[model samples]
Structures are given as C-alpha cells and as structure tokens.
Target: MWRVFLCIGLLLAIWLRWRCKNRRLLEMARKIPGPPTIPLFGNALKFMCQPEEFIKVIKDLMIEYGGVFKLWIGPDLNVVVSNPDDIKLLLTNNKTSIKGPQYKYMADVLGGGILSGSGTLWRKHRKIATPNYGRRAIESYTDVFNQEVDLLLDVFNSLPKGRETDIYKYIVQSTSYTVCQTLMGLSKEETMELPHLQYLIDLSPKLYDIVFDRMTKWYLQIDPIFWLTESYTQQKIFKEKLSELSAAVIKHRYKALANSGDKLHLMNSEEDSSKNTQLSVIDRFILSDELDSKELIDETFTVFTSSQEASAKIASFFLMMMAFHPVCQEKLYSEIINVTGKDDKPVTDDDLKRMPYLEMAFKEVLRLFPIGGMLQRTINEDISISSYTIPAGSALVIPIYHIQRDPNLWNDPESFDPERFSLENTKKRPTYCYIPFSLGNMDCLGRYFGAKLVKTIVVRVLRKFKLNSLHNFKNLRTIIAISTTSLDGFHVILDSREKY
Candidate 1:
C-alpha cells in the first residue's frame, strides 16, 4: 500500500515539473530577458525587503538585461523599460494598454476619478478638464497661489532667526490652502480642516501596505482575512474622513451656487467664463451630470489627496535643496528680484519667462526627488523590442528616478546643478530624460497648473527669506506613495530679509 502511494505522488510531481518547464519554454520563446524567477514568488520579495532601494535594483536589472526586461511578481510578469526610445514607442502606440492590478490598487485609494478612471470615462474627463486649465483659468488661480505664498512667507518671517523648524509643515499648509481654495473655494473653517485631512492622507499608505501587502508577502498570500478582519480599521476611518470632507465641500459649493443669482461664486458666468474658464474640483463635480454624488466625492478626494501631497513635497524639496546650496539659491533669488522688483508682487506669465535660473532649480529638484517616480503601462498587443517579443498584458514600468540619475544620460548626474536645464544644455539631452511631468496622453493632467503654482511659491519664499537647514542634519528621509514625502519633515531655519 505504501509503495503504491509513493508511485502516485511521484507521477503528480513529474507532471507539475513538466507544466512548469513548458510555461518557461513558452516565455523564453518570446525572447524576453529577465532574472531567474522563483516559483510562487518573484521580484515581490525585492519590493518587500527594500522598498527604498527597489527602484535602484529594477534600474540595474534593466541596465544588465537591456532596456526591456521581464520581472515576475508571483504568476504575474512585469516588463520594465528604461530606454527613452522604447518608452516613446510604448506610450505613443495607440494599442498600448495601461489598466492593470497595480493601478487598481491606486484606484482603491483614488477611486474612479479622472486620475484612476480608464477608457471612455477617462477620455471624457480629460477633454472637459483640459479647457479648465486654459491660460485664463490658470491666471485666475494665481491669486489663490499668491495668497498661499504670502501666508507661507509671513510664517517663515515670524520664525525665530536661529531656531530650526520643519519646512515641510509650512509647505504642506501653503500647498493645502492653495489646492483647497483653488478647488473648493474653501472658507477659513473648511480650509482649516485640511491638516486633519492630510493626516488621513498620510495614514492611507501605511494602511495600503497592510492591506495590499498580502499579494506580495509569502506568508500572507492573497487572503484578506487578516486585513479585512483586523488590520484595515485605520484605512476605513481615513476613507470615511476623506469622504466626509469632500461631501461637505460639495454641499457647501452647491448651496453657494444656488444662493447667488448674478455672481456664480464657483461657476463661471458667460462674461467671466470667457476670461477665466478655470473651474475648481467642485465645479467639475457640479458640472458632471454623469457622475453620482458618491463618484463626485471620490473624484474630489483624489484631487485633494493627490494635488496637496505632490505640491507639498515639491515645495519642501525646493526649500531644502536651496538651503543646502546657497549660491544657486542666491542666483535664482536674484533672477526673481530682477523680474518682480522685490515688492512682494504677484508673478505674471511674462515675468515667469524671464526667470530661467529659477526654472532650472525647479527642474533639478523634480529630477532628483520626483513625486511620481514611476510611470507604467501594459502591452495591449504583442510588441517586439530589439530581440524580444513581449506578450500582451505585461506591465512596463519606467523609473523616472533612474532615468534622471543615469550616468550615461547626464554628466555628473548626482550633483545638484541647475545649469543642466538651461535651454542650450537642455536641448542637448533627450526629451524623455527630463520628464517629471511624464509624457504622452496619459501624463499628469495638471502639469501646467502644478508648475506655475510651485514656481510662484518658490519665488515668493526665496525672495522673502534666506533658507537654512538644522545643524547636523545632512539627510532627509522620504516615503514613497503616489509622491515621495519627507519622513521626518524638512527641517530648516528661516531668516527674513523683509524684516530688516
């Protein structure tokens, strides 16, 4: 009886090995390059063990295996692309796909907003939304940006000269106000609610890891039993808080619009509409008949969460980098003073054109500490790159950070030199080498608005004060979410030039 059982088990094992080998043979026949993958687990362990270093590992793998390489996470195979030419090919190809499980996890947080929505829904939202970011609309939002910057400058001026404080908190406050005002037309009380909202936003990532890490973790498997039953309470609370804030803004805006007769506070009238077509997030929600209240809330939440987070990180990075590099900061500050004449005046688009050094500084910071470090797309159809034939449904990750720091791509890539972005030098580099805003149709929808807002704030802050970091603090640790965030807050000292 024992001998017969052993024989049956051996046959089953042989069949499994045959199936495994056959699958590998098929994958190889496609001629894709990749590292040796272990069964039931792939590159997932790499992400789990070293979250911060994973981007570097993926980049090195791409360098070794070629621009197009395949990596597996359990049964799933991801194709990574580092070469600009291939990235351009993938993104420009109409047949290329983007929807994948990784994005779905983002959707779990972002919901079915323009940021997370795909297909016709995403297209329509993009179409309607593009007009809102027109020149006139962005111009209208300049007041909000300037207002936030003024508040930030005032706060910095009030700080004790020698005392160290975290610049990140101030950056967050300034960014949060700008985003909330421009989007919701939020009142003081409503705007004050943002710190709490930010807290919720900050917590969501930790909760996301606990919830979604199941798929990546070997012991956890795909079962939601642990996360659902025990680990996800905080996530639920944060989601509820986000929903509440969005719902309140929607209700308030709806009431405000209904009350006003001639002056549409949030909505654009015919006359004003021609001048400033920029609609807030709430305005978009109100205009969207196809979207339900729940959907509106979800979309607004995504906007609030994404915009505030990215803007804050960018602001913090700029301040910290400038503080550490005084000469560059002074050069940029001189450019700003030249343009604005040091009267705390609002920056016009024409003025922005003259501040090329400031632009370079912004670009440099973005290159080093990009908010969205990776851009991803899935192959919708079979595509050949070099010697490899890639199959459909495979994910392609473009690590922006790696591309930014590639030694082959840039001379002294690690250094914080802003001159690399001068028009002459910039023209020498590949277009894809400097894409913090990404490229193609699916790139960040609010890139222009974000750029303008960040530039305005940087100019305002630098013109008003000299920034310095806390003593002995050489490094700023960052957390990766939809954006890279300072883990400890960007600590710095401020010296107000205006006061003297």
Candidate 2:
C-alpha cells in the first residue's frame, strides 16, 4: 500500500511540471497564428515526417500565417519572423544577442567559441577575433588567396576540355586548403596528409543532419534521452575525432613556440624577423594568455567548419550563375580584362577593386544563394513585435532565405540581374533586407575575407575558361545543412580561353 502511494506521487509531480510549462507556452502560441498543434506532441509530428522539406514548410507557414508565426515542439515555442522590421528589432536589441537553443547542438563540435557561446565569453572572444578579420587583415591575405587560386587553375588545366566537370568538388578542396593554410597554419602538405581534414569534409553534412534531427525531436532535447539515440552516439564519435585533430594541431603549434623560448604575447611581434610570414589565427590564440588550449581548438574548428564550407558553396553557386548568364559572363570578362590587361597574370587586390561589374555580379549571387539560410536567437526578455507578445525564452527564427526573396522588398525577386546590386538600387532597399552576412552586432566577422576570396577565385577562373553549364538554373535545388548548398553538384564545361 505504501509503495503504491509513492508511485502515484511520482506520476503526479511529472504531470504538474508538464502542465506548468505548457500553460505559459500555450499562452504565447495563442497570440501568434501557426499550423494546428496537438496537445502533447505539438508540431513535432508534422516537422519530423518532412525534415528535409523544412525550408519549404517555413515558406508555406509564412504565406499561411503571415510573416510572424509560432512553431511548438512540445512545450518549447519557436516564433519565426521573416519580416525585416521584426528582424531588425530582434537583432538590434542587445538582450536577445544570445544564440538560440538550437545552437547548443553545435556546441559539441564548436565548443563555447564565438559562433556558439553567449554573454561575457562571446564578447571576450569576439573582441580578440575582430581585428584578425578586419579590412587590412583580409587585404593582407590576397597573396594566400592567389596562391590557392593558382593551384585550382592548374587542376582545371589538367582536366580534359569539353567534358562536364563537377567544379564544386575542386572548389571545396581549394577553399579548404586556403583556409587551413591561412588560419590554422597548416601547410599544403600537412593539410593533404591530415586524415581528419578529409573526415571533417565528409562529416560536415552528417553532423548538420544530427543537429536538425535533434532540433525537431522534443525528446532528443533532454541530455539523458538524447544519449540513448543513434545520432548521439555518432555525434560523440565525431566530437572525439574532431577534438583529437584540433588538439594535436594546437599542441604542435604550442610546442613550436615553447621550443623557441619566446614569451607568448597578445599581439604579434613587430620586430621579429618572421613578421613578413603569415601569422595564423591559431598562432594568435596560442600567444594570448586569456585563451586556453581547448579554447584554441574550438575557435580553430569553428573557423575550419564555417570559412571553407560557406566559401566553397558560394563560389560554386557564383560560377554556376555565371555559366547560365553568358551575357553577364562576357561583361565580367571584359571588366577583368580591362583591370588585369592579361589573363595570364594572377588577379591582384587592385585588379579586384577595379572590377565593379564583377563585384556587382558577385553581390547579386550572394543575394539569391545566401549560405546563411536562417539566423536564430533566444529571447532573453518578453518582447512585443507588431502587436504580438513573444514570451521570454522563446526561440526567434529569422528566415534570411525568404526575406531576401520577398517580392515586397525586391523588384522581380527571382530574376538573375546583377544590376539589382547597383549602388542606387541597393540604397532603395531597407537596411536589413539584404542580410547575406546578416546585420547588426552579431554579423559575420569574415564578411570581407569571404567576399575577397570569392571575388579573387571567380576572377581567376573566369579569365582562364569560358564557362558553360548543362544544368538549368530553374531546375537546381538546394539543401540546407549548416550552410545552403546545391543538392545536385554544380556541373560545368570549361573551354580554354587561352590565346596561343
């Protein structure tokens, strides 16, 4: 009789907890229109059944319920806002600066790095990292970009002409090579030999899938329950391999500096003979006393995952866009020729600056094929947007993909016209409407670095080959892993533009 009463008490406590949580969330949900939610499961059943079609689902929701709506996974509420006005209000508000709950999934791979951390930790790391990706710092990396581009062109030259090639593969490896060398201090030879580098390249999408799976499944949000799932086991193995790889690299760099008997400093030594040599981001971290070895590994992995993945996809899409629009390609080529005067020479920083039309075309590509498909933030305090009350702790989802393509914001949103990015037209759009790198304080630090690298590679490739694609732009589909990528690899025929 006593044992039976204890069991009844335990069941009652669980029921009460669930009821209390749902009571608050349901109140917020009632204020925002959304797809019908069942009592306990909420929208999880619908989302889980069609996870791959999430972007389309969100687009549909935007149409049905208007710009702002709620998606409930059990008691947790996610208020998705596609309106620029809402996005502006949310991002600009300093209190909502913390990354949303979904980003916690990335913490296993990225740790408490700038991309995944919040509060004082994020602020401290961001301050230290900001200078490394400044205009001058990015400009200094032009030689590294050119070097990588040369290797890429050499591979293209070796390939048989008139055959359709999957250029995305080469671009991915080339961008990886560039980022590894420039940021992690990994030489070309070292990068090629690192098995984990290949593992990371292959595992990126899988890791992303794990995060997505966990995000949609309410049960997986609980640590003890998530550990029971296969994704958890896979993620554990991935984290181990990634950690080992990063730790080994960090240890090697640390040992090298120690052997030299030089005291680590916050800033790079100006008087040192090695000043001319590229100081890797890892090297900077090693020199800083504020950061530990684990922090160094996390930050380096974050850069590796973010920089190469996004840059490769963006470059691939830019090339595909150029191939489909021969008129734009010709105009771009003319600009390149005018700037460099010869296709044989590598594109310099000055040459890149002179190609305004090329820059315009690149910007347009970014507008359409933004790698950052969505940005998420957790509301730290109760907020009101457009007469709707979003209770504190609710996740805020900003659909960058939808916002950029909104017809209300852009004229003929679907057309591939580089002229849309022209200075006059760009000024006409709202401030947050064109957020390829996002907007406000939490925007991407590597915006200029990424842009420079893409432009440099595009200029070099366009100058060497006349691009042609068998794939139609209208038929192309994209998958949103961490970054948006073409589902079907970018295929193009490279005809040599060499004038012998």
Candidate 3:
C-alpha cells in the first residue's frame, strides 16, 4: 500500500512539473501569437496526423498566425518564423547558428554525423568533408555522373517502347547506385557482392521512415514511451545490427588498404592524395583519424541518407515537371543540344555552367518541393524581432515549404515557371526569398554536390528521351518526408530522341 502511494505521488509530481513548465513557456510565448494549446499536450496532437496532413496543418497555422507564431510540442516551445526579415534575423544570429536541439532526437538514427553534429566535432567533419564536395571536386566527378546517367538510359532503353512507366522508380535505383559509387567509393559489383554493405544501404530508408514518424509525434520523443512502441524495438534491433555491419566494413577497408600499402589519413594532417577529389567520401572519413569506427559508420549513413534522397527525389520531380511542361522540355532539350551539339561527347562542367534555363527549371522544382521542407534552429539567447522578444532555449521553425509557396512572394506561385528564375528576374526577387538549400551558417554542406548530380541526371535523360506524362501536373500531390516526393510515382512515358 505504501509502495503504490509512492508510485502515484511520483507520477503526479512529474505531471505537475511538466504542466508548470508548459504554463511558464506559454506565458513567455504569449507575446507571440500561436494556435491555442491544450493542457499538457499543447499543439502536439496537431502533428499526430500523416506527414502530408502535417504539412497542411503548419500551412494552415502560417495563414492564421501571419509571420511569426509559437507552437508547444509538449513543454517544448517552437517559434515558427515566416517573413524574410525575421528569417534573416534568426539565422544570422549567433544564438541560432548551430544545428537545432531538435535534431539531437535524430542522433539516435544519424549518430553524431553532420545531420546532428555541432561545435568542434561538426567543424572538424566539415573541414575534412568540404574538400571532397567543393566545385573542383564536383567537377572531377563529371565522368562518374555521365556514366551513371548512361546506365540510367540503358534501363529505360531496355524497357518496352511506348508504355507508361514510373520513371522515378528507375531514377531511385540509378541515384542509389550513384551515391554508393561516388560518395561511398564502392563498386556496383562490390555493393551487390557484399551483403553487409548492401544491407546498410537498404536499411537506411526503413530507418528514416521510423525516425520521421517519431520526430512528428511528441510522445515518441519520450524515451520511456518510445521504448514501449514497436518502432523502438525495431530501432533497438537495427542499432545492434548496425554495430555488427559497421565493424565488418571498417575491418574490410583496413585490410584492403594495408594489403595495398596505402596509408590511412590522420586527423589534422595534410592529405597527400594526388587530388582530394580523387578520394571517395569514405576515404576522407578514414583519413580523418578524429573519427572512430563508429563515427565513420555514422558519417557514411548520413551521406547515404542525405545524398540518395536529393539525387533521386529531385530527379524524379524534375523529370515529372518535364513531362507536364513539354514546351519547357523542348526549351531544355534545345539548350542541351546547343551545348553538346550532336557530338557523342559527355557534358563538361562548362556545359553545365552555360545552361542557365536548365538551372532555372531545376530551381523551380526545388521551390515547389523544398527537400528539407523545414529548418529548425536552437536559440542560445534572447533576441528581439518586431514587437516580440524571442527567449533563448526555444526552437525556431522556418517552414521553407510555406515561404516558397506563399502567394505574396511569387507571382502565380503554383504555376511552373522556370522564367521566374531568369538572371534578370532573380535579381529583383527578395534576398533569401528562394533558399531551397537553406541560408546562413547551418546550411546544407552537400547542396552544390547534390545540385550538380541532380542537373547531370536531368540533362543526360533529356538527351535520350522526350519526357511525357499521361497525368496532368494538377494530378500530382506531394508527401513531405525525409525528402518531399510525389505521393504517387512520377509517371512518365519516354519517346526516344533517336526515333525523332
């Protein structure tokens, strides 16, 4: 009887503590407007809906609250900022430069890799990784990009002619293969032959699904509550299995390098590779003695998760847009033909640079479906914006999806217009108005590399096929997840350019 009473007392005390925290946070946040909150829950239930529905809920909230508003996820306060001025103020502020505290939740899956890393550790990883992704390095990968694109074309050519197909389906495989080759620095044959390597790659998508689900639902953030769920059980199993596979990879690489008489790159040491671009991402990580075996695995997972999504999903979206807008397709095809000009030569970095319209069309695709969708920042100190004082420790939520689609920001925002991105029009747009790859210190490190790959695939595919859709753009719907994706596949029918 005494034990039962003690348990009840502890439960009640915990509840009261969180209630008081929420009430106190609500008091501070009252200066900023927001959706009404329920006791204990706040706006947590609002996010319990599906990912697509969750995107809509936030869009609705943005409409109701105007520029800046607060949302309470359990006792946590998140201030959603809309306009460009406020976004600049928050992002540029020293307080919010580090990855948001919210991403720490992702650390369970991502570990301390770039996605959730901060401070000295993040800086070190960035320094070593940056050289591998810079323009000179990306320029070096042109051959690999062309190779993957040609393989992608081979897949299309092998298919029966004149049939409606899901181009995104084949695009996924191609992009996945690209990530393994270019980023992981593994051969396709090796990826297929090595079960452990393939398992790690295949396991990521499933883990992302589970992680995103947990991220949206506030209760799932609670360790005790999450432990009770099936998702936790699966993650627990995955965690152990990942440990096993990662060790296997580390062992294999060490043996291969030792046998080849190649030296491992050490932390803070000068890289002696003929060119940093020639070494794959895994090579750089292995070189950086700062990262242990586990950290290597974490970084590898981070790259695969980030790279594969942007490369595949954006390629899908870009191709689908081509099918929907044939005139734009002809315009892009003409540009490609003008650049390459009937020579069976591969596209050069210079060729990619000359095609501004192609760049514009790609930008528009990202604007419609910002891959990150939302950027969250952790506030380190109090900051004043407009009439409200944003307190330190609260999270800042910048909904990129809402900003890009806000009717006031873009003329006929829903209409696909690559012309909007014309150099002349681009200069007239508000600064920071179009940030598909976020802005400021915490921006995506892989944006340039990802964009390069996306453009490369789109250009090569256009050279081989005229993309057409059986479905209209209006029929397309998106589900915002790890990456924004068309709810249904990007259904496309390819007319071989050869037939012309």
Q: Which is the leading candidate under TM-score?
A: 3
C-alpha-based local distance difference test score of model 1: 0.71
Better lDDT candidate (1, 3): 3
Taking the tens digit of each residue's C-alpha lDDT, what string does model 1 give over 1-500? 99999998887687577557658444653477778766556666776654455556766786788667777876566777777777677776765645555666556656756776667777765664565556667777877788778878888878778788887777776777787787556776677754466675456446545534443445454547546545456666677788887887788777766665443543444444334454555765576565777777787777676677677778878888888888888898888888888888777788888887888898899988887777666666777765566676566677787788788788898788999988899888888776787777778877777788888888888878888765432465554545665666677778886664
TM-score of each: 0.87, 0.90, 0.91
- Lowest lDDT block of 10, candidate 2: 270-279
Off by over 4 Å in 3: 1-12, 15-26, 196-203, 236-245, 259-275
- How many clashes in each structure? 0, 0, 2
Model 2 C-alpha lDDT per residue in residues 1-500, reported as the tens digit of each score: 99999998887787678778668766666878889988667787776654458767777788888888888877668898877887788888886888888888878668878877877888777776666577766777777889999999999999987898989889888898898777677777777766587888877767887876676667778889988889888888888788877776776667667655443542545643134334566766667656876787788788787888788888989999988889998999888888887547767788887888988998888888888778788887888887598888788888887787888788998778999888898899887888888777888878887888899889999889999988777887876665777777788888889742
lDDT of each: 0.71, 0.79, 0.78
Worst 10 residues of 1 by lDDT: 265-274
Clash pairs for candidate 1: none
The regions of model 2 sitting more than 4 angstroms off are 1-16, 21-25, 49-52, 217-230, 259-278
Give lDDT: candidate 1, residue 238: 73
- Tens-digit lDDT track of model 3 for 20-45: 76564556788899988986678999
Q: Considering every candidate listed, which one attains the maximal lDDT?
A: 2
